[model samples]
Target chain A: MTPQLEILITVVIVSSACAALGVFLILRKMAMMTDAISHTILLGIVIAFFITKSLTSPFLIIGAACMGVFTVYLTEMLKRTRLMAEDSAIGIVFPFLFSIAIILITKYAGNTHLDVDSVLLGELVFVPFDRLVVFGRDIGAKSLYVMGTILLINMLFIAVFYKELKLATFDAALASVLGFSPVFIHYALMGLVSITAVGAFESVGSILVIAFMIGPPVTAYMLTDQLKKMLILSILIGIVNAIVGYWISAILDVSIAGSIATIIGITYLFAFIFAPKRGILAMIHLRRVQQIEYAVKSLLFHLYNHEGTDIEKEESNRHSIYKHLHWDKRFLERVLKKAARRDYLSVNKEYLKLTPEGRKYAIKSYEVL
Target chain B: MMFLESLLRDYTLQIVALGSVILGAVSGILGSFAVLRKQSLLGDAVSHAALPGIAFVFLLTGVKKTEMLLLGALISGLIGAFIIISIDRYTRIKFDSALGLILSSFFGLGLVLLTYIQKRPNANQAGLETFIFGQASTLLKRDVYIMIALGGIILLVVGLFWKELKLFCFDCEFGKSIGFSDTKINLILSSITVLAIIIGLQSVGVILMSALLISPGVAARQWTDKLSCMVILASVFGMVSGVVGTLISSSVAHMPTGPVIVMVISVIMFFSLLFATKRGILWRYIKTRRDSRDINECKILINLYESALNHEEVRHAHKTTMLKPIKSLHYLRDKGYIRRDYLNTWVITDLGMEKARNSIDKNRGERV
Candidate 1:
């Protein structure tokens, strides 16, 4: 396979893994925690690198994972103190840890190969340079294996604990009573997220990792109601994002991670505005139709209530009805026109009179409303 | 005295420290309100959102004028803040997801633009990326003046609308009920927060700026429950960290100021959480332990007295195994509430009986 395909595959694998685990994160209202973890894991990787003094050491991944979990633990501990709000706790802890890491890099590790830019804005174009050679045999890109393992781990975790995770996410108290420790599942899920973050860190950087994690999941959320379908949809969206984002970045000669993040944002914006049922435009359209329907029903009711009454003329006049109903004159006219078109009311001598069909319609609306 | 003399002699140090102090003080004041209103993450989103603005401005002007770039940032940050508000308010998306989405995507766009500008033949040294991890030691005197002016304006706005802001932070529904427009008040609050963030960004950078906004507010919260005191304490914390962080970074080789300031403020937050007088973990733990100990002693004495009354005997021996609060038993003996009668038993003294009766009467009275 060519290098471009290899890079694309790396991105897709990373996105799929992130999006898969991200479903549970967003459902648990932890999108921001993922943000906190992604940034803080840099600190962990730095510390681990210092210990092992090797970028390729497995300890870096382990340290990143540990630090990700530690971020959640510290935020929760601070929140449990009830001295500050939850988001404030996250805002405090991650920056503190990340700052320490940055400071360490700037002051002590400046001479090392580790560059802060790579930590923030990872360059996937360099993927072809780092080939995995096993026993002097040429293999694939190293990111392929790392991200693939993370992807498999995420899938296995979701598959093995599907029911438990579902129960725990929706209702933790009941899940706890039913013999599944939600706390354990929670920590385990966070651990996987951190691991995925570490694996993807090289390919997409820390900040863009959030785009992969949350973008596809939220977009899927906009498109689907079923959890299984949402998870599958997010994975597909992640794949598409990786492909489209890579192409855009390649064409523009810009940052691939940035392009991918922008694509994710645009995709979610599209879903937000144009999804069939839940999209903003669709809801707005539904509200407009509902408004006209309700207004016509109001006209029917008003005409039916005053039918053959002493004040029927005074109440049923279109110009006067707007005032009586506290609606705009133009709106009352629109409602009147709608009622007449439906044969629910007849206008004669500038006063509305309910038709025989109109009387029945008013009674039906009364029952339904 | 030597340090003070050095501070006076060093022109760049004076400028950077002064800028950091102003940035810290204003952000701290506004951050207290943000923390109370649960908008701590808003500053993070706004700061990141400002990046595309700066880069875009530089792309257009081809010159890195701080004021022009900051103006672009202000516009961009406001738009980002508005989008976050709209997403959270109109859609089913929660506040946190909206924040994370906006910050990352905007930062990414900024990166794309920065890289784009760098690739241009005439782009020259964009140096635009430095805003990500701001170098406080490079702050100019003009930047310090801008920070002071903006800082003063923020302070004045906060003072002028103190009552409305307090109402908005603690009780928005009540404020709405009393005829303050919720949207208007929210606009004022977010505007000040955005300005404060803009002022701090050049010193602390985008990523750590949130810490500057949140840690001081949270640290001050541990010290006091009142909003006025909390805001005052928070600004003081911010200034101290700013000054100290600057001093330390200036002394150390290859040290960037933003992270050091973040580290210093975090230490302050950690200590505040640990040792604050009212809400600190240590204080609460001690209070709980002492309360439990008192309750245990009261129960042991009350048990001896009740058993004596039941047996119709002045001296009733109780098993040491049954009354298992060994430490409380020793304390009761020391307090003259009970006495050792046998190897495995103890009896309530007259003093213990009277005390238990009075305590039981008081409990009954309170319940009634």
Candidate 2:
């Protein structure tokens, strides 16, 4: 396979893996925690590297993954302290840890190919060079195998504990009462998120890692409400993002990871503005339609209330009804026109009267509301 | 003394340190309000969002003017915030999803612009990456002045609107009930908070600047419940961290000032979390432990007293086997409230009986 194929596969595997766990993370309201984990794990990788003195050592992955879990642990500890809010706890802890890692790199490891720049703003251009050779055969990029395994592990964990995870994620109290430990499930899922971050950020950078992790799942969430469908949609979106981002970067000669993140943003914006049922335009249209319907009903109700009353002339006059309802005159007129068009009301001289159909509609709306 | 003399003498150190101090203090004062309103993560989002603005300015003007770049940053940050608000208000999508999405996507666009600039043949783009992982040693005198001016303006705005801001932060519904426009006040406070985050973006980098905006307030809140005191304390903590971080990083060979300052403020926050008097983890733990032990001893004492009432004597000996052992009974014994009559029996004294009556009444939750 060409280097281009290798890079594409790496991004696809990483995106899907991150998105797989992201569904659970966003559901648990831990989006920012993943942000914190992505940064703080740098410190873990740095310290682990200092000990092992090798970038390819599995210990580095273990150490970084542990640090990701440690980030969650510290944030939770600070939150349990109750001195600050949850986001403050995250905002405080990760930077502190990441800064120390950064300080170590700049001060001591400056000459060791371990600068802050490359770790944070990852470079996927170098993926082809780091080939994994088995028995003198150049198989593929190392990231391909690593991220692929992580993706498989994510799917397996989610699949094996599907029942427990679903119960725990939606209703932890019930899960615990039913002899399944939600806290145990919570930490295990976090551990998977950590391992995935360890693998993914090496290619996509940390910030874009957040995009890949959260963007696809959230976009999927916009389209569907079912968990099974959300997971499948998330992976599908991740694959599309990887390919489109790759094409943009290739055409423009820009950062591939960055272009992917930008693409993710554009896709989400498109969905947010034009999704079938939940799109912004659709919602605005729905509100407008509902408003006109509501206005017609209220007009009918108002006319029905004033029929045969001593103040009917003042209260039920078509031109003066806006003052009583506190609605705009133009809006009232529009509603009146719509009502007359629909045969819900008619004008007798200058006063408004509800027809039989309008009376029935008004009573039904009152009962339904 | 030597460091202070050098700090006074070294022009670059003086400028960077001064800039750090102002950025730190301003962020702290505004951060108290941010944390109070639970908008602590807004700093992270806004700072990250400011990147594209900075990049866009550099791309257009081909100059790295701090003022122009910051103007771009301010514009884009506002746009990003507007997008976040619209997405949150209009869609079923969660606020955090919107926040994470906009920040990362904007930063990504900024990265694209930056790489596009890097590919261009321009020496003027030398220190542009410093905004990502800020290099304080590179701060110019003019940059420090800009920091001071912006910091001063923010402080003034915070002061002029302190009353309305306090009400909005604490009780927006009550403020609205009494006829203050909650939306307008919220907009003003949030804009200034964004300004604070923007000013620090040049010195602390995009990712870690949120720490500067959030840490001091969190630390100050541990010590004081009053907003005024919390703001004051936060500024002091911010300034101290800023100055000390500058000093430490200057002494080191290749230390980046941003992360070091983040480390210092974090240390301060950790200390506050652990040791502050009123709400510190240590004090809260001690109070809980003492109260729990009190409840345990009171239960045993009440048991012994109630049993004594069934008998003729006010102080009756009871066998130890029937009751679970209370470890703090030694506390009662030391106070001469209860005594061990034999190896297996215990008796309540008159003092113990009176204490048990009080404990029962207290546990009953009301009294005459």
Candidate 3:
């Protein structure tokens, strides 16, 4: 495969794996934990490298993965004390651990290939050079195989435990009552998140891992409510982000991972503005519509309440609502027009009257209120 | 003594240490409010978000001056803070998701801008990466002055608003009910926190700045229950870590000052977690052990007293298998709580009866 294709494939696999786990994380309200894990895993990898003296050793992966879990463990331990909130707990632990790793790398391992820069901003341009060869047959980039395997593991884990995970995520108490250990499931999922973070670290670095893990899932969440659909949509969104981000980076000659993160941010922005039910636009429109309906109903109630009374003869008029209800002229006109179109009320010269249907609607609204 | 002498005599070391100490103390004071408000990660978000401002200022001016870059960082950090607050207020997305989104996206933009600058022939971006992993040793006397000025301003603001901030954190609803605008207090508090983060950005960098802000407060929490005391202790912890970390890193080759400081604070936090008087793990463990031991001892004494009440003599052979073994009875005998009579049965002494009565009273009090 071409180098571009290789990079794209690897990015997609990593993004999808992260996005899938992100679905669970978002549902579990543990999305920021990915950021914490991504960072603290560096300390794990650095310590592991110090012991084995080889970056390629599986011990590095194990060590980094252990640090990821350790980050979660420490965050939880701090949170359990009730002295601080969850985010504070995370904010405290990861940086302390990550700083340790950076210091260690810059101090003892400075002469080596290890440094804080590459750990935080992995170069995709270098991925193609490190190809895996089995029995003298050249294969794809090492990142591709590594990320591919991680994606498979994520898929398999989610698939097998989908029901239990869904149950635990949505209703932990009920799941526990049904014999599923919510805490066990929680740690297991965290373990998978750790492994995925470790796999993605070398390719995308840590910050973008948070981007891919949280962005697509949250965007999908804004777009949909169903878990199954959210998972699928997030994966699809991740693939698009990977592919589009790759091309943009290629054209602009910029950091591929960074471009990918920027693309996901843009995607989230769009979802935030334009998603059908939960989007800002929809919410505004819904509020506006509700306001109009409310104005019309209250107008009808006003007419109904004052009907056949001397007060109605004294104060009730078509233009009086603008003064009495303290509504703007434009708002009153709009409400009047809507109410007339709906046959809820009619205007006769100077006074307004509610139709029988409008009377019923007014009474119902009053009863409900 | 030598370390203290070197700390005072070495001008460069003194400048760096002074800068770190100010950064640590300010971060600690603001961090307590941040941690209590559950906005601990805001420091992380705002600091990371400040990166773009640094890059933008460097790009626009082609200068790498500390104050100018920090101005840009402050603006950017405030913008990031604004984005987080707006996202939270405007959208259904939770605070955590909004934080992660802003943090990664802003940092990503920063990386892009940084790389863009690095590619330019005119931009000498060698020192730019220092803001990611801070190099405290690189700080100049001028930078220290700037930090001190900023730190003083921050401390002044905190001191002046101490009562309002305390009420705002402890019970915001009460503060609001009493005519303090919660929104205004929140805005002021958030602004100060971002400022504290921006001042520390050059010393600790973005990644670990949150640690500077958060760890001190957490450690201090273990040692005190009062907010004012916690804030004071946190600052003290922060200052100690700053001095010690700077000294240690200066003595060692290639040791980064920021992480070393973080490491020192972390050590303090760990110890506080384990050994603080009121809420430390060690004290809680000791209390648990002591309470259980008291119950066991009380049970044994009460059983012996009951056996004596039933019969003229409390026989060691009496079926009190539910109680501790015969060795405990022997232990009570040795302690003079029980005496072996002519029949080889255990008899409660007057002192033992009084002890049993006290134990029963204590148990009853606890139940009540």
Candidate 4:
């Protein structure tokens, strides 16, 4: 396979895995912990590199995963204390670990390939060059293999523990009574997150890793309610972002990771504006249209209900009803035309009168309101 | 002893130490409010968001004056925070997404700008990277003085608004019911949060500044239940972490002060998490164990009383072989729950028998 195919495959695997894990994190409100893990893994990577003196060492992944877990552990430990909130705990721990890694890089390994920039930002472009060869045959990019394994593991874990995860995510007390250990599930999910972070760090870098983990899942969440549907939607969104983001970057000659992240942001924006049932625009438009329809119906209903009154008794001065109702003339005219078309009202010469159907519809609306 | 004397003697080190303490105290006092409001991530977001502002200022002015740059940073950070709040209020997007959105976009924008600035013929842009990871060594007397003064102003504001802050955080609806504008309170609280982030950004850098703000609040939280006490303790924790971190970094060869400071704060947080009274892990463990042990003892006594009741002669139950049970039973007997006879058997004492019956009655009550 070509390098381009390798890169695409890597992006798909990594993005899907991140998105799958992102769903739970976003639901549990632990997205920032994923961000924290991404940064803290730097310390693990640096330490591993210092020991093995090779970036390709398997120890790097192991070390990074340990640090990622350490981040979660520290955050949990801090949270148990009354002195700090969960966000503060995450805020406090990861930066310190990241700083230590940076210090080590600048002091001892400054001349080496290990540096703060590469560790924090990563080289997504170089991901395809780092091939994993077996028996003199190029198997594919090492990142693809690593991320693929991580993705497979995540999928399996999610499948096996779907019920427990759902129960814990939605209501921990319920899960506890059902003989499901929420804490165990939580730690297991976090562990999967760590491994995924380590795998994705090589291909996407730490900064964009958050976007991968948070964006697609959040977008999917806005569009669906069912956990199964959400997971599926998130994976689909992730794969779309990877492919579209990659092509966009290739066309624009910009950073692939940045492009992917920007694409994710754009996708979220689109979802925000257009997603059915929950989109902001849809809600606003629905509310406006409902209000307009209500106003029109209410005016006609009030007039029809008070037929014997002075305003309704004088059918020759029907335009005067607009004044009593305090509605705009233009709106009244438009509503009158719509009502006439629907046979809700009849206009004769210079007067307006409601038909039997219009009267019924207006009364129904008023009653409902 | 030598290190202490040397630390006191060096004026620059003393300034750095004093500056860090002041910064830490400020962050701690404000952080108590931030943590209470559950806006802890706001500090992190603002700090990251400030990057674009700093980069923008540098790009526009072509200068590296800390004050001017920070002013721009403050404005942009506030804007970012405002955007976050507005997005959360208006959209279905959750708090985390809003935070992520502001954080990534602002930081990404900053990076793009920094990269652009680097390609220009400007030497001042060289130190922009330092903001990503702070350089505490570059702090001078002016920086120290600014930190102290700003920190003092923040502390004063916190002191004056302590009651209002507490009321707003504990119950905003109540605060509003009592003629307080929740919006105004929120604005004030968020402004303070943004101010804290901006002030700390210069010394702690973007990545670690949030830690400086949060860690002390966390550590202090573990030690106290009262808001006032938590704030004071958090300030003290922050100050100590700052001072110790600065000292460690200065003393150690090639140590980055920001990370060192963060590490110190983390250590303090860890200690408080494990060792604080009432809610600490250790305390909770001990309390749980003690309660379980008491319950177990009660169970054993009840068992002994139940077995004793089955005897033909309850008064002469001392010779019963069934009385001598587990080792814990013997210990319970020594505690006056049971009387041991010469035949290596046991009899339930009147007090023990009564207590055991009451314990059994309580268990039955629970079932009912």
Chain B TM (all candidates): 0.95, 0.94, 0.90, 0.91
Per-residue CA lDDT of model 3 for B156-223, tens digit only, reads: 88988999999988898899899998767877887888889887877788889988988899889888
lDDT of 2 by residue, A156-249 (tens): 9999999999899899999999999998998999999888988877887887788888889888988898999999998899889989988999
lDDT agreement with native, every candidate: 0.89, 0.86, 0.86, 0.80
RMSD of 1: 2.6
> Which candidate model has the greater lDDT, 1 or 2?
1
Using all chains and alpha carbons, the TM-scores for the candidates as numbered come to 0.94, 0.95, 0.90, 0.79
Better of 2 and 4 by DockQ: 2
Q: TM-score of the candidate numbered 3?
A: 0.90
* Candidate with better DockQ, 1 vs 2: 1
What DockQ would candidate 2 receive versus the native complex? 0.73
Model 2 docking category = medium
- TM value for model 2: 0.95
Candidate 3 residue B314 Cα shift, in angstroms, is 12
Give the CAPRI class of candidate 3. Answer: medium
Error of 2 at A129 (Å): 1.1
Ten residues in sequence with the least summed lDDT for candidate 2 chain B = B320-329
Overall local distance difference test of candidate 3: 0.86
| Candidate 1 per-residue C-alpha lDDT over A1-369 given as tens digits, one digit per residue, 9 for 90 to 100 | 799999999999999999999899888988899889989999999999999999899999999999999999999998998888899999999999999999889877988878888978888888877888999987999989888998999999999999999999999999999999999999999999999988888878977799888989988988988999999999999999889988999999999999899888889889888998888899899988899998888778877888889998799886688888889888877877787888988887777788899999899889987
lDDT of 1 by residue, B79-173 (tens): 88988887787678788888888888888888888888888998864467778888787789888888888899899999999999999989999
Using lDDT, give the best candidate's number: 1
